[model samples]
Target: MFDSRHIRTFHAVVASGSYSAAARLLGYTQPAITQQMKALERAAGTPLFTRLGRRMQLTEAGESLARHAETILGTLSAAESQLKAYARLRTGRVRLCGFPSANATLVPEALSALAAEHPGVQVELLEGEPPASLRRLERGECDITLAFTYPGLHEEVPDEVVEVRLLEDQLTVLLPTGHALARRRAVHLADLAEERWIAGCPRCRANLLHECAGLGFVPDIRFATDDNLVVQSLVAQGLGVAMMPALVLPSLSLTRVCGRTLEPAARRHISAYVRRDHLRIPATAVVLDMLRQVAANRVGC
Candidate 1:
């Protein structure tokens, strides 16, 4: 019988395309990966890989074995998830990641609810922008991620990821207390065509440009930063105006800055994403449930 560890290493090597890459993914040295592959070939009674220069190519037997290995590993993973569920979620860890605004807003309430309900479950949190958070989720570094996409600007979620929409986050124009547009019930993008702008991250700035182009004007962005608080501070000091999502607006002081809805209503769709298999994990499911509830309550929906 072959050891599962050897088979797992073989699978990693095939997936990663090189021993060094597999070692990095599996937290093993290159020599260790080489040894495991050798052992696996011996157990199978056939050579599994052929070397073409520096590249490793799987043999016919290796291809057959790889298919079986995937089935075996997938079954094992499902079995482990089932066992954890049978244990009533008394112990297990769920790693969650999210963008900055979601981390500050809905995530806190969801985490609080999770802790109160599942006292025995451990939680880990990571903060990043939407793209980075999604990358972590794909790499298995996070079980779930809170991510957002501007409806007209960002592409749809990838087919491999399972996403659950939480809420629609509306964008608001933030102006200095003494600015001419500060008291408007809603501000049109064209109204601020001549004002200097404070922009957010690259994705946000791109979206701003797209929206402004629709209004027949391009903003003169004088400042750029990913930090929402810094953007607010700049606006507060009368440096420039900015557009921010509703979720991040709560973090800004209203004394020096005021937010008004956009006339055409720019918005983003906020969602939680996970690998399809991760949805079977009880802890992940619980956290997703709590997040949905928090979003519903916040939006009064």
Candidate 2:
């Protein structure tokens, strides 16, 4: 257990060739420099200096410690510099996890802005739906997670995390461009009772079943996929109808499908989940703020 302060003092003494000279350079009295040297020798479990004529010289152990001191100090100094830079948001890594829609919409905008503002801060992104991303957040696999819950469902967050509601993502029904309800301003869930359905992720599928059950029928789901493109393609081919968040619709080139807002106005609450301890991290804080701003400026959610 060598003290860094003691190691530094020893290095100074070795550099200056005498305790008195080292003390002068370090702005300490000679006695203080001598005491630090003694402490360093005690930590090393060997005598470091021996009197040679009128001057003190390094013993074998002292020479060994001197040989390694500069490298040790260099590593220590670099570590300190990196920590300071991280504290100032000058350099860091922020890991983010998000669902498909939010990743396609909010995340790209927020991350793009973050890159322009903090280029030294590296970012890693993972795509996972609500409970999955939330699990990653709790386990420390990710620093921040963007997750959402439907109108009829709520996600149970871990006690160690804090959830921040960002926006309301309106659920819209996607219909084939030539379908009878395509041109309608809005469509009722019950109106699609006879149509085959394309389900999304597990949570989205569950939300679909929940909303339909409330309207007195179960969706005849024939295709289950989480890819938004697949959902859009199925609807465009007149194969099935699916509910998608309005926020992601703009990002997709939707020439063959018409997305209408649900007649009952269903919406999901999109939120940012972060471990309580991570809120203090500068890069994570910056990323979280950017997400808020991007969500705030968006048309829906």
Best by TM-score: 2
How does model 2 fare in lDDT? 0.90
Give per-residue CA lDDT, model 2, range 122-151, as digits (tens).
889899987888888888899999999877
lDDT of each: 0.87, 0.90
State, as a TM-score between 0 and 1, how close model 1 is to the true structure.
Answer: 0.70
Give the per-residue lDDT digits (tens) of candidate 1, residues 1-301. 8998898899899999999999999999999999889888888999999999999999999999988999999988899886866468766788989888888889889989878888877879898887888888888898999988887645455677898989998999989989988878999888889999999888889899999999899999999998888888999999999999988877776579988899898888888998888788788888899999999986721
Candidate 2 lands at a TM-score of: 0.94
User: Which segments of model 2 are wrong by more than 4 Å?
Assistant: none
How many backbone clashes can be found in candidate 1?
0
Model 2, clash count?
A: 0
